[model samples]
Target: MILYPAIDLKDGKAVRLLRGDMDKATVFNDDPAAQALEFVAAGCEWLHLVDLNGAFAGEPVNAAAVEAILSQSKTPAQLGGGIRDMATIERWLDKGLARVILGTVAVENPALVREAAAAFPGKIAVGIDARDGRVATKGWAEVTDVDAVELAKSYEDAGVAAIIYTDINRDGAMQGPNIEATAALARAVTIPVIASGGVSSLKDLKDLRDCGAALNGAISGRALYDGALDLKEALKALAG
Candidate 1:
């Protein structure tokens, strides 16, 4: 399992939101590029970035911050938020994003996902953020009745690279990830599912590693920033 350190960009600063609430964010670093480099420095294999402003805007608003991270780090990165159309996908890929995650659009227009997957091959991933098993869209601002497992199943044959599954209620709360729910979703589909939301300690990471489902990896934010989870130690545990 690969360990992905998260850098959530809000207004050009790296911050972690409490349960997807923009108003409840805690800024971790003013220079996101330096923060990304720190992760790379810590031996992290991959970086997970989300454009918070972009997610709500329906377009990329943290372009400069993202560009800064890309310019500094050679480590492969996956980004989600505000990537809505073919043009945006093309642009991000051109900007050197290793993988572009299609979240909101995956729910609004699945055909675009198929088309983009066909075009990008392994460079495209689907982000399914759910609350109580229902998918949320528009930056987790709206909850839909669509079952998360069903949505993931629909993309199984679309040639998408992977699925990033975040349990909304657990995100940023540091309550630990919903392993049962996330693993159930993983078993329901063949796509590689990366667990997100609350990844708090070495135990949490190890639990996910031993969870039996074939998950891609896990994304940790607050725990890492709050010093609750040591990056180097967590990486070592996941690698084990």
Candidate 2:
């Protein structure tokens, strides 16, 4: 399983929230590019970035911060949040993002997901943020009755590179990822699935890896920032 170090951008700063709560954000660093460099230095293969402000606004709000990280890092970064249109998707990909993750669009306009995947191939991915097995849109502020597994199955033929599954309840809580649910989603879809949310420790990564072995990668945020999971050790564990 691939270990993706998460850099969540809130007001142009790297911050982590408690269970996806915006008011509970804890600023980790002011320089997101520097933080990305640190993760690269520690041996991260890919970087995961989210625009917290953009998610709520339904548009790109942290372009400058994301550009800075892209400018400085040699590592490939996949980004999500407020990337709802094809123009924005093309813009980010043109700006040199390794991949663009479409979350809200996946639930809202799935045809665009298929179109982008066909046009860009591996450059497109689907981000599914769920609260209690129901997919959430607009940055987890809105929950739908859509079953997570059903959503994953809907895009099976879309040719997306991967499905990033995030459990909002476990996110930033350091309680560990929803391995059972994530693994179940992975099994339900032919496309690759990357587990996210509440990845708090080395054990959590291991558990996620075991669960998502048939999947692609795992995303970690507060765990790495809070010293609960050492990036180097997690990398080694995932490699092993």
Candidate 3:
């Protein structure tokens, strides 16, 4: 299991939103590139980035910040939010993104997900963010009736790299991840499932690891930023 330190970009600054609410953002750092490097120095193998502005606009809005991070960090990073079309996907990949995560497209336009996944195997992933176990789209602003597991299963044959399961209610709240729900969804799908949301402690990571069936990795943000979890220790534990 890889511990991805999240550098969520909001207005070109690293900020974390409470419950996925854009208006409720807390700025953690102004220099995202430096932040990315810090995470890499801390021994994190991969970085997770989200474009908050892009997710709402349905287009790339924080390219400069993302580029800065890419240019400075040696570790691979995966990005999501506002990456809806092939051109955007191509552009990001051309700019050196290791993997592009499709959330809205996976729900609104699945064919595009298939096309991108087919075009770039192991370079595209689906971000299934759920509120109340039902998937949400457009950055969690809109909730759909689709079950999170069903949505993940729909993309199994699409050849996506991984299914990023985020429990929106747990996100940025330091409440701990939805391990039971995430484990259940992972078991229900063939694709690798990465857990997100509310990962506040090392104990939480151990719990996810102990799930033992389909758990792949977990994403953490606020806990890391606030010093509640140590990146180096977590990485060592995961690697061991």
- Cα lDDT over the full model 2: 0.93
How well does candidate 1 match the true structure in TM-score terms?
0.99
TM-score, every prediction: 0.99, 0.98, 0.99
Q: Cα deviation in Å at residue 101, candidate 2? A: 0.5
Candidate 1, superposed: residue stretches over 4 Å from native = none
Q: What's the CA error at residue 47 for candidate 3, in Å?
A: 0.5
Q: Judged by lDDT, which candidate is best?
A: 1
Candidate 2 lowest-lDDT run of ten: 206-215
What is the lDDT of every predicted structure here?
0.94, 0.93, 0.93
- Kindly report which residue stretches of model 3 are placed more than 4 angstroms away from their true locations once superposed: none
Model 3 weakest lDDT span, ten residues long: 209-218
Q: What is the lDDT, from 0 to 100, of the residue 219 in candidate 3? A: 98
Candidates in descending lDDT order:
1, 3, 2
lDDT of 2 by residue, 1-240 (tens): 899999999999999999788999999999999999999999999999999999999999999999999999979999999999999999999999999999998989999999999999999999999999999999789999999999999999889999999999999998888989999999998899999999898988777766634968899999899898899998998898
lDDT for each residue of candidate 3 in 32-95, tens digit (9 for 90 to 100) = 9989999999989899999999999999899999999998887899999899999999999999
